[model samples]
Target: MVTTGDAAPDFTAPLANGDIEAFTLSDRLDDEAPVVLAFFPGAFTSVCTSEMCAFQDRLAAFNDLDATVYGVSRDSPFTLNEFREQNDLEFGLLSDYNKEVTDDYGIAMDFADLGVHGVSKRSVFVVDGDGRIAYSWVSDDPGVEPDYDEIEAAVEDLS
Candidate 1:
């Protein structure tokens, strides 16, 4: 997996808003702005919803730090759209449905227990303007959420 001070792997994927577009780590971290990339196991799960809702609730603070937040998962665009609307998420929820980005970041899980395929582990990465990973956190258990405080602190340092 990509580590701190290493260049963040860049990829382009479709967004949940039916926009057939793409975004890269460099594109997001332009102009000295930081990018908060959160990866969840799936959409519509209880823990994922709660984690995203918490980010939505704290949107202002993240903006105050000049950070762009992105929630990524292996969920399809359709599912991502529903998840965004249902949770009132203010940030972009990227559809890594193909697992291209997930695999590039080395976060894809084996799914030994669930018989699922192409699922991303719950993880987060904070990339600085230079496209280097400033901070990262991955949940030991896929069901757990990331440490928002630590993420916020990392963003603050960059700001």
Candidate 2:
């Protein structure tokens, strides 16, 4: 996975916002808001749900820190669309079906044991406007969640 101070890899992926449009990582960073790019393994799973919802729950705080959240998964946009609605997720859930984005970010993992291939590792990256990763946390265990406070403080420190 990407590490702090590394240049964040750029890619576009289908959005789960029902618009049939793609989300470009660099574009979000250009908005002058630090981008909180989160890569979860899949949608609709218990651990994934809690992770996404935790971001949703603290979205306002992230916004307050001048950050925007985006959750990436290997699931299709169709699947993520429903997952977002079902969980009341207000942020965008990106579709990295081919795992290109995940791979570019160096977070792709072989989960053959779990019956999933090329799934993304549960990772979080805080990218500043310059496209540099200000903070990064990649969990080796799917059940582990990143420290939300540290993520928030990292972005807040960007100013």
Candidate 3:
């Protein structure tokens, strides 16, 4: 898996912020702000919803640290937009519908019991201005959540 000090793999995916738009990770890197990529298996699920809402609750803290945060999932842009609206998420949600980004990041997983496959694991990667990952967290258990305090500290360090 990608870890601290490793260069983050840049990707372009459909980003939903009440609208569908192309989001390029490298483009966001130009401003020298830390980028938080929170990967979840799917949108609108209980755990995913809680995780996204938690991030939304702490969004101002991330913004104060000049961090750009995005929630990623295999859901389509349409589903993501509706999820954002329902959750009142302030940050953008990226649609990794093809699962390329999730696979590239080495966080892809399967829900074999449900006959679902190629979804993202619950993970979080904090990339600093240098495009290097500053913090990494991955959980095989979908119910688990990342340490929000740790992520905030990671972004603060980058600033």
Each model's TM-score, in the order given? 0.93, 0.95, 0.98
Cα error, candidate 2, residue 105 (Å): 0.9
Please give the lDDT score for candidate 3.
0.92
Cα lDDT listed for each candidate: 0.84, 0.89, 0.92
Model 1, 103-142: lDDT tens digits are 9988888677878976888899998888889998877588
Looking at candidate 1, the ten consecutive residues that score lowest on lDDT are 17-26
- Is 1 or 2 the stronger prediction by TM-score? 2
Compared with the true structure, what per-residue lDDT tens digits does model 2 show for residues 68-151? 898999999999999999999998889999889988888878778777788999999989999999999998898899999999
Question: How do these models rank on lDDT, best leading?
Answer: 3, 2, 1
Off by over 4 Å in 3: none
Error at 54, model 3, angstroms: 0.2
In order, how many clashes per candidate?
Answer: 0, 0, 0
RMSD of 1: 1.6
Index of the highest-TM-score prediction: 3
| lDDT measured at residue 125 in model 1 versus the true structure, 0 to 100 | 91
- When summed lDDT is taken over every stretch of 10 residues in candidate 3, the lowest stretch is 24-33
TM-score of 3: 0.98
